[model samples]
Target: MKIAILGTGAGGRCHAAKLLELGHEVIVGTRDPDATLARTAPDHMGTPPYRDWLAAHPGATVCTFADAAAAADLVINGISGDHALNALTAIKDQLAGKTLIDYAVPYVYQHDSAHKWPTPWGFMPLLDPVDSDSLAEQIQRALPETRVVKSFVTQEQETVVDPKSIGGGDHTMFVSGDDEAAKGRAAQLLREYGWTDIVDLGPLVTARGLEMYAHFHSAVGLALGRRFGVKIV
Candidate 1:
């Protein structure tokens, strides 16, 4: 598969490495490819720069967002929640009829000047009207012609690359999308990454729950005092 991951940050690099390991041709997409490569410091999440990860994964290459999306068989929206909407919206034309795997939560990153305390996962606030709309639904609405499947938003970035590290043997993944075939394709990729218990929670609107579930996932992280995930059981 010619897979394009939209973002060279931790989640993107992790997924790109896994895809390459699975023998897929991976192109990592970013708004500014050069800037992403030139990044010398670790990201806010503490993952090493993309350049560092790219050094280990030689098979994967970097490209502008448009080029990556235009050349891909499938596109993974691994971009951060804050920037995902604008980035994907701009390239909706190329995404038509293609399956897009959305891994972003609906939270927008913001500095907490008033309080030093942070949410369980980290400090961030959700975009407006979250009760009525989800990030995945918004993307689906914005790109009505494209098939969008939402998954992987509730896990830590490490779990995306390696689901086995989570102590829970049956950690579950909830996928939501309007297109069955598209959801199937997304599930296949998740299976390749070793996710066994995946639940298709109906159509795209169900993403409201999947995205909102991040808060609980974070609470689990807090209890564990480490990165964590969820399980249906």
Candidate 2:
């Protein structure tokens, strides 16, 4: 299957690399492919430039967000939380009648906060539309024709792609979406990525819980000082 990963961030790269290894044709989407490839330095997250990463994995194709989505059978939205809605909306025509697995948490960085939850790197980014609404739900509303499934937001991208790295791949992965078939597609991909335990949280609104868990996920990672996984059992 041809899969489009709509982002060039570390998370997107993780999915792209893993998908290529899984024998799927991968198309990576970005706002500007040229600018994404011209980067010589790492991103704020310190993930190396896209060009450097692409060099190691030449099988994946990089193009504009719309072009990638147009060519894909399925789409994984790795776009940053703040920009995903607008970015996906811009390519609405290409994504109609397709399953969109959104893993982005709507994080508004550098916001004013009376009580800051500082991390080893910086303060925890704020999640807008957090408790009552979620980025996944927002995207679903924005693109009425697209089937949106929320997954992969509960864990770091590394663990998401290679679940065996923690707990012998026994951890639980959750999927939430309005479309059953779309959620099934996401579960299939997770299984391909080596996830053995998956729970369907039922309906897109459950995405609020997944997105809101970001803070807790970060807190646990900081406390342990490592990458970890969570299991329902």
Candidate 1 collision pairs: none
User: Per-candidate TM vs. native?
Assistant: 0.91, 0.98
Model 1 residue 21 lDDT score: 86
- TM-score between model 1 and native: 0.91
- Per-residue CA lDDT of candidate 2, range 1-233, in tens? 99999999988988999999999999999999999999999999898998999999999999999999999999999998999999999999999999999999999997999998887788888999888899999999999999999999999988899999998998999999999999999999999999989999999999999999998898888899999999886
Residue 209 in candidate 2, Cα distance off native in Å: 0.2
Candidate 2 Cα lDDT to native:
0.94
Error of 1 at 228 (Å): 3.1
Q: Model 1: number of clashes?
A: 0
What local lDDT does model 1 show for residue 222? 71
Rate residue 122 of model 1 by lDDT. 59
Model 1: how far is 34 from its true place, Å? 1.6
